[model samples]
Target: MATLPYWRLSGFYLFYFALLGATAPFLALYFHHLGFSSARIGELVAIPMLMRCVAPNLWGWLADYTGQRLLIVRVGALCTLFSFALIFVSKSYAWLALVMALHAFFWHAVLPQFEVITFAHLREQPERYSQIRLWGSVGFILTVVILGRVFEGLSLDVYPVTLVVVMAAIVLCSLWVPNAQPSSGNRKVLADGFFKQLRSPGVLAFYACVALMQMSHGPYYTFLTLHLESLGYSRGMIGLLWALGVVAEVLMFMAMRRILLRFSVRRVLLFSFLTAGVRWLLLGSFAEHFWLLLLAQLMHAATFGSFHAAAMTFVQRSFGPGQQGQGQALYATLAGVGGAAGALYAGYAWNTLGPTITFSMASVAALAAAVIIATRLQEDRP
Candidate 1:
């Protein structure tokens, strides 16, 4: 712990997720303020996710082949900043869509490669990952709370500028992070071994569950703000609700080392999926009830915090050193596929089937993931 470049690695995650905090809850609202319909907002938001499908794989392969993950991270961050700045130039649907795709292409390239760098730095101390990662939740909480208040007092016009500032912070942090490499001796063997391992039944099942888990989040990420706002909650309150979820997540992260030490990763994942299923159902059915909505928000600890931590550990253990970049990239790719699908479906459903049915659909997706993990994913030590 004393020897690790802990602050550098943690700082990158802080700003990276801070960018997420700014966009995830507010981007759609900004689009709505521009008078776009639900369908258009969905399409615009999905554009970046669609880019995730292609960008991460391409960048990951390049990072693996060249062994310059940190260099790629820096370049990707700079490009993301420039591309996203184009949002200031236009409010046309086509223009915003293009900006989303362009910025996300580079933005998506940063994290998978950076994950490889962090793990390399951790080396033998992977369990400490959550301690470092918890700062990201803090960054998220700060942005969500502050911006929520800002938006309450100001216009949505400030949204783009706020994002640009966060992106700039990400660029600065990317430059500050030191590079690290995984083992190189088995490069050829590990490189060739990636596909072979990916083909195994357990790995295939796990990836499928990954897609489903993210797909289940579509309604929440794409419309929760709007949904709560319709119910008359203030922007300041909505932001706090979002922050509360991440606060639970931070607490979960603080306890994850102890939890992982006592339980299998498979168990943690199963629990996460189960809780997600329940959370979505509650949100769909009883969102008007403050206590129920609060309970659902708290379940974010299981849905994102535990699920992500366990999945990261699983990926790290499943792939070899040479395959780390590709492994993380593939994970991001699946998440992108699921998220895109979710946003598109939620957008169409939010108006047609209504919020209850739309959220129920999300619940079903989560339950299906729970089933997959229960019946298919084999038990593994954490």
Candidate 2:
């Protein structure tokens, strides 16, 4: 196979995340169409994401040990394609849950390893990292908008097939992706242990802050569609709004190199965490204004994009080749644990307190996250 272009790296990012954009916005609605109850949908959606806690770390270790991260990515993409395509085979809650778990099990293997691949290439230069990964945001937005428009005509019945098609494309791209050349780190160094790594003040603090941010997002992802649907927005509009957020995310990724140059990653993380609080509060308080909603979507740049990029940069700087796998695993673990808890609580909150109160809860979570970062997270320069 020919060497992959730099843009092709971006292409892979775009396609994978575009698959996310295609599904995340509409899956709840699809479950609704299939007669699943609201709480059930929330639980179902959370299951796949929640599985990230265990799956990624296991796969990350496999890649590091075998030096076969690209092969894992290919396997994950193919499994995702197959498992997602089987979504139509059964509609029972148990069966759907099983399918989602299997898909997520395979799906979760791609990201952390891919992060390793990107960093392995750009270890000496992180600026290019965002440029490649930013294509993911582009893919996400483009897919969301097109599908949003498509769903305007078709009923939600097409959700399964559409997701399958996109996921299969991701697999095909994975097949063509160029593999990473392994690094020659100290092969004998093994005593560093996960706890010792966590003892690093910077890593611990960063993980804490990230966990909080992920926690804050729980309600929005769990019930945002249901919340809006209850408020009378059509499915297409919801998808468009989702696309709008990704557009903001794309812009931020494009600008991330400049931002990092000017600002410390810790500082950026702090600001993003703070902004998330404000964003969630505004979303809770101002649900009716279309313009306000659009503006809030734009805040996704800081809330998720900047925050995520900062975290990734921090990982790359803090960990060595020997520790890279474990570093990424820890990040995924904290995110998964934090995200799952946040999403579960949000589901409960939405079930109990309704949208305004549930979203207010999310805002509170964001604020708590900001405080954790600001208080525990320290930066020498910023």
Candidate 3:
């Protein structure tokens, strides 16, 4: 039996999500600082997500074929750092778009493979998955909270430097994590007919639902800070609001085992979609109310926290061991597609439809996802 390198795994997630922390709250703000229109900002931001649709699946296939996941992770992390470094050369929309495309192509490849590696280490104890994964929430909170103040004190031009530091950390952590072996003899069986399992109705519905869930997050990820700024909130407050949502996510991760024990994954997923719908509706209707906004942020416990936990477990169980990388990659792919669509629409809608209508569309997406899961997905009980 292998001892789980608890902190090693945790450290990787911490640094990895820390990069997200920097991007999610401030990247759009950075582009805004450059005086780009909302649509251009959306296009810039969407570059990475658009790459996610193809990058992870291609990398996952290679990892499965070669069984060298850690090697792939390290190379991907290193390339991401190099690509992102190009931002210093030029800040033009064309230049930044090129950099974002290259950076995200490599960066997005790191996570889904690492997810399989994490579960590989956990082996028979999948319940411990969230405990290990919660460090990512911790990483996000620290970055959002600190960078919030940092941006307030300094200029948004400093954002890229901060991201570079985090990217370096990711590269270092990738080097530190050891390669995990595939499950015993499961690879051969899994390799034989992986795509056959992918054709199931439940699997199809689950990916569709996953896409919608991520699509609904577009406005939040792409423009929440700007929206709050428009509503008279400080930069620090916007950061705290972002941290608050992840704090809710952290708490949910801590209690995920208990939650899973009591409810079926289908039940949990249905609840997550419904709660996400409410969250979007509240944000669209009452974003000017700080208290209401806080309440809506708390729904992150379900929107991302429970939804992600349930969805990851569902993917793990749905496929055999050899196919886990692809399972996780498929999740990333659909999420990329959804996120890209959401960000694109949110960009166009932010100026024309306004935040209320923009986010209302997100609410409708989540509700529609709920309908899909309720009708098409079955409870995965073993």
Candidate 4:
């Protein structure tokens, strides 16, 4: 039996998400510092997500064709580091947009391939994935909480420095973790072709719901910090609020084994969509109240934690061994498309319709996802 490189895998997730922790909460604020409008900020943030629509599938196919997933991850990590370094050269909107899109194209390629590698390592025990993935949440918490305080002392100008450090760490971790190919026997068990699996009603519904679920997160991902700041929340407090959500996610991941054993993936996903709708409604309606905001943040357990674990499981079970790369890639693609749409719409709506209506739109998107899951998603038997 091969030893699971638990810490290595965990370390990569830690640094990768630490990068996200630094960027997602503060990037909009950084754009605000540069005096960009909400629409432009939305476009800037949406660039990487738009890249996700195409980058993952392209890279995923190459990985599957070549069987060099880890190599792809390494090259991607390096490319992301170099591309993002260009941000320091120009602060122009066009330049920044191009850099973000370029960096994201490579950055987005890393995760889906890494996910396939991780699943390859886990082999038969897919449930243990949450255990390994929880480190990412811990990283998110640490970065958000610490950076929240750091940004309070410093300005958003320090944001790029923090991101660069985390990105470098990702490259180092990618180098440290060697690849593990699935056994030939496992690969031989490819029962369904990728396209055939994708053609299933359940598969189609699941992907649609996945897209909508992420779409619902657009405002939160793109502008939650700015929204809270407008409500008189300090940077540190906003970071804590962001950390609070991931803390809930970490706890949920810790308990995911029990959750999975008790509930069907379809059921968990349905509940996630419903909770997301409610969470968005509360966020839009009562963000000024600390308790309500905290309560809303707690919903991250359902919205992302359980939803993601369930979605991964659905993809794993739906696609055969040879198809894992494409399955994960497809998931990333739809998520990217949905996220881009969400960010674009949120950007347009934020200035004109304001935060309340913008978030209400997120709520409607979540509700729509719930309906799709409820009506069209079928439970696959173990």
Candidate 5:
């Protein structure tokens, strides 16, 4: 039996999501600080997401074919760092857009492959995944809380430097993590190919639901900080709000092993989608009410935490060991498609439809996902 390199795996997630902690909440604000319009900001922010649709598949294929997931992660991390360093060179809209595209191409390549590596490490003890993954939530919380304070006192100019530091940490952690191939003995060899498995019962619907769930997040990711700023909230408060969501996510992750044991992944996914619908509605309609906003943020536990763990389990079980890389990659790809579409539409709709309507649209997207899951996704034991 292999001893889980538990802390090392957890360390990689820490830095990997620390980079997200820096980017997800602040990157748009950074673009705003640069004087870009909402539409342009959406486009810039969506660039990486757009790259997610492409890069992950390419890198996933390479990893699966070569059995070199860790090397891909290291190369992706290094390239991400180098590409993002170009941000300091120019603030022009075109330059920033190009930089976003370049860095995100590499950045998107890291996670899905790393996810495969992480699970490969976990092997038989798949339930322990969230225990290790919760460290990522911890990383997100630390950065958001600290940087929230940091930005309050300093200029947003520090944002890029902060991201670069986190990216460097990711590179270091990638080098530290050991590679794990999916054990040949444990693999379920399917007679059908990757696409056939993808078309298997409930699989396609699940993927579509994944895309819709991400699509619903567009306004929250792209504009929630700006929205709060418009509502007279301080950057520190906004940071706390962002951290609040992940804090809930961390607690949820800690409980996920028991949760999964008690509930089917299908049930968990359905509940997640329904909770997301309500969460979006609250965010759209009641954001000015502090308690309501807090409740909405707390729903992140269901929306991302439980939903993600359940989704990973589903994907892992849906495909054979030979196809894990592509399975995870396709998951990322559809999510990218949905997220990119959401950002684009939110960018166009935000100024025209305003926050209430923009967020209501997000609510509708989430509910739509719920409906799909309730009706189309079948229960399966993992």
Candidate 6:
């Protein structure tokens, strides 16, 4: 019973992302267990994100205006816990969608603003942001691999219970996390959307690029585990493979400060997108080749790690403290819209086009992201 002292910012991220690790990779499989079709699963899974389009901003606005950041996180987590409690009743799509929408509406609210919280704390030493964030990867990998093994002989009904526990942890962490509030802190409503800040050509281009790269991940998130299962990989292996991707992400985060010092955020994103295009292409073309598949997992550092870290940096630098909450909200909204579309489309395309063709589209989308960066994104000297 020793109290955990919050340091720099990494401890919170470890718990925060560990929650994500417990869920995102496994939710699809959980839906798969509900006797739902892939398409139905996509819809169910995407509902929370789909709701994120508006929910996070609404919550972010409240946080920015009220200066009640911790309360917002607590409320979001409580709603998440309460919303999921009804999930056992979700034997059908309508019921599931309703529950999902409710939970997601709240769940999405916490992160966008909390990301701002993390960044706010890291204002002086931004490089250490990843050192803390890497714990989230650790949490994610731990959950995926352990849960994968646990699920090999078990059924999928356990997803909700596991999710609730993870979410509760997030809430607990938020309650204990102390962020310094600036004396000048006050939020003013802009009549227009953050789209104004995005009026800059480079900013717009960067946003579009992120949207594309996230969109390309649709197929991989929706069908990768099932596809691997069809290829005869066990649940345990799938979890570890998923864990491997996080491991790479964690490694990338540890080295992120050094990397950022040397390269521009735009350059990192461009490289990540290009690597994603190639990674999905290879996975689709040679999924049955295990070693090749592992190599593709290694590329996850580019697709997710570098790409995400760069995107966060861009967001952090793009807007000042006044717009921090909304800034994070905008990224969540865009990712939600793009990621939901990708996951949904990939689900439908999955059985018909097959992983080969489906993942080819992923490559195409990621490549398009790279092209957008080349044409639209121009960064000043860092």
All candidates' TM-scores?
0.98, 0.95, 0.98, 0.97, 0.97, 0.94
lDDT of 1 by residue, 154-261 (tens): 999888999999999999999898889998656677777999989866798898899999999999999999999999999999999999999999999999999999
Give a tens-digit lDDT track for model 5, residues 162-259: 99999999999999999998844322243246778988889999999999999999999999999989988999999999999999999999999999
Model 2 lDDT tens row, 262-316:
8988789888988888888777778678888888899999998899898898887
Q: Which segments of candidate 6 are over 4 A away from where they belong?
A: 1-8, 182-195
Q: Residue 315 of candidate 5: its Cα lDDT?
A: 90
Candidate 1 regions exceeding 4 Å error are 186-188
Clashes of 1: 0
The number of residue pairs in model 4 that clash at the backbone is: 0
- Stretches of candidate 2 exceeding 4 Å from the true structure: 1-4, 187-195, 380-382
For model 6, residues 1-382, the per-residue Cα lDDT tens digits are 2222336345557666776766667778777877889888878867776887889779877877787776787788888889877888756889888998898888887777667767666667667677777877888889888888989878787778887787777777777777654223423334243556778568877867767777788888777888888899999999999999889988998888899989988889889999999999888889799999999999988898888888888887776666777778878888888788888888888877888998999899999988888777876444
Report the lDDT tens digits of candidate 4 across residue range 76-115.
Answer: 9999999999999999999999999999989988999898
Query: Which 10 consecutive positions of candidate 5 have the poorest summed lDDT?
Result: 183-192
Q: List the residue pairs that clash in candidate 6.
A: 10-132, 21-140
What is the C-alpha lDDT profile of model 3 across 1-382, one tens digit per residue? 8889999999999999999999999999999999999999999888899998999999998988788889989999999999999999999999999999999999988999999999999999887899989999999999999999998999888888999999999999988898795664555577665788888768899999999999999999999999999999999999999999999999999999898888899999999999999999999989898799999999999999999999999998888888888888989999999999999999999999999999999999999999999999987663
Q: List the residue pairs that clash in candidate 3.
A: none
TM-score of 2: 0.95
* Worst-scoring 10-residue span by lDDT in model 6: 182-191
User: Which regions of candidate 5 fall more than 4 Å away from where they truly are?
Assistant: 184-192
